[model samples]
Target: MKKLLIIGTMPIILDMNADSSSDSEEEEIGETEETTQKPITCLISHDECYVAPQLLNELYVEIFARVPCSEYWKLQFLNKRFSQLLKSSEIFRMRQKLGLVKPYLFLLSSGANRWTMFDKDFESFLKLPKLSSNICFFNGDKEVTSVGTQLIVIGKEVEGITVWRFELEMQKWVKGPAMITPRVMFGSASHGTNAFFAGGVKIDKNSYEVVSIAEKYNAETKTWTAIHAMHKRRKLCSGFFLRGKFYVLGGQNENDEYLTCAESYNEVTDSWELIPNMLKDMPVLFSQAPPRIAVVNDNLYLLETSLNELHVYDVNANAWKKLGVVPVGAHFTRGWGVAFKSVGDELLVIGASSARPQSQSMTVYKCRPDVEEIVWEECKRCCRGVRLNHFILNCCVMLA
Candidate 1:
């Protein structure tokens, strides 16, 4: 049974609508109205299985948690008992207890209303349910982050700003449970089942104010808790989690000036420690996306937008060491369109083929920057097929 869980990636279509009859809140597999579109898949292998009626349910839950959540639908074939467990959140809860998770990359491209979800290896993809809000939510700028099984998308609607969430378990877009103070251009990051949002602009009437407020969302409770605000008011910043701490890095301030400083939030102390001039030497354009930064194994790595080069942060010296250019381009757009994030231990970057040239097809590459040697390995499988919009409006990595 354990062997069935560790098999290599075998792509299979996931009909998210497979079991809509279940009344479980955590297992909303699929609710798609587009019958013409393709389905999703899971990392799987074909094998025989038999359920022992005498086996403890706890043991089964432990075993099933090892399987990818994308493959949960297939588990119904095991037996009636297994089917019941799949509909419930018991196995998912066990997964969290065991700290077992896989990252799924969600991307929203330019000029496109629908978002796409790709498996870790980019073996197969799934289109998220369309947003149920007004046109403003689609055309305006969007900030996205995922907490646990939910993918939260924030943007404006017709009359005012709104928040839309893509619930992975329910397999649909749900409106509301909005932010305590609705915002845009915020810095957001996720750790485990919780997501953190901080430092953005709040628009009311004709005026918009850059804000320093911070909030945390608990996926289980479906609620938000306000936290200690950062010492600085900045928008267009980036948020990352490292060493049990949340860090907010480089962004533009309320005065329309670029800020080189950063802030680190200590959950234990319940306070934010201002890290002044943390990015004083960082390279960026006059106006662009937040610093292209991602953390792996407690070390922070940054992409120099002007050079398309990779640099590692020195925690002791508070400096950066250049690691050479990434396989993808970034200089042309000044780092606006690139999707930079840490996928497990490797640094995953998706962008154009060159620093200056443009292409309809984006390149996908990953590298282990923590080791002695840094080599960008291109996911050739991901580059093929229908190409993505070269300019990524937003990208998020959700651990399920």
Candidate 2:
């Protein structure tokens, strides 16, 4: 087959099946600097990428790693070298080592055709490529989490349940190497390159079963490894990493009983330590959303859905202290539509703006919860052109 590489209005056709081998890739790049390999300010011609050694593989990886991830799609059509480098995801690994991996926000709104992606500043936005799935996937409840540069979305379609991954460098969606076990309403959290999922409802033909199973996914291998299960079988719980431990909190047990206890997994021992009554003091409302939680500056904060209040978790005391009222209408949908996450050193909350028309715009706020007094400063200039539905269906942050 042939290939057509198009960038903007210009169209360039080339052989897609070309092997395009190079000697520069074989050179050792990780061990030391390539002192003998010379650097060129620019590519002299498109053909030189494969036919000659102009840029060292280390230089290419370092240059691309520093470039904003938003511009990765454009690099795809540059040449065969750029395409292969990105497709291999070597740049992503370098980004981690260089401490250049930055977070990006992805929001799936109610009735939206595509997921909207925003930079950390929230000044600009773009729509991600639509998922290639049946209507069952879009309409059904979805669980989303980000591992490294990939966005993993889990939901049911016509073919039972499936996992779809959105690769950052490729700028497209691909059917996943499915999870170790397919489940719904699972608690998930990402630590560096690995994603943790645990305690969910595993659905089958006739009935659904609540499970205590847990699994960890390695993004580099695109593989899931089964981990030790939680002490209690729960669904609708939430998961987050705090103080180097994976914590699962607040969900319904196998017998449909509301659980206040929490569990933490220790990788050193591969066992779960159950903490009873971790959320006992908080009032449990009917059909409440799974604890809207975020950890900022090593401090865990929970968005109380019933009263739009914020509370900080005292890890030592195992208690929650109310901070103050939030500006959004979190209780409108019982906390389902709001997005709570930690972006860098601050707590970010996005939801229906209580003061204005929620259908036309979302309220964005961020605060450093570690301070003596909490102050949520709203981002008044977020994506003015595209009025987003405040009722966010799901949200995830990708560090790429």
Q: What's the lDDT for candidate 1?
A: 0.77
lDDT of 1 by residue, 1-400 (tens): 1112333343222333333334331121112333213211111221223323333356557756877766666677655556777656677688878988778999988767888889888878887778777776778888989877788888988777788888675466788788898899888898767889999999998989999999988877778899999999999999999789899998999998999988989988779999888888876577877898999888999988888889999888888899988876688788999998888889999877774365677678888887788989878899344568878888989888
Model 2 lDDT at residue 368: 81
| Model 2's TM-score against the true structure | 0.87
Error of 1 at 367 (Å): 0.9
Model 1 shows how many backbone clashes? 4
**Against the correct fold, how does model 1 do in TM-score?**
0.81
lDDT of each: 0.77, 0.82
Candidate 2: the clashing residue pairs are: none
Per-model clash counts, in order, read 4, 0
List CA RMSD, all candidates: 8.9, 6.1
Encode model 2's per-residue lDDT on 54-160: one tens digit a residue.
44556557767877887887778866778878877689989988998888999998768889899877888988898989999999999999988889999999878
* Position 74, candidate 1: lDDT: 69
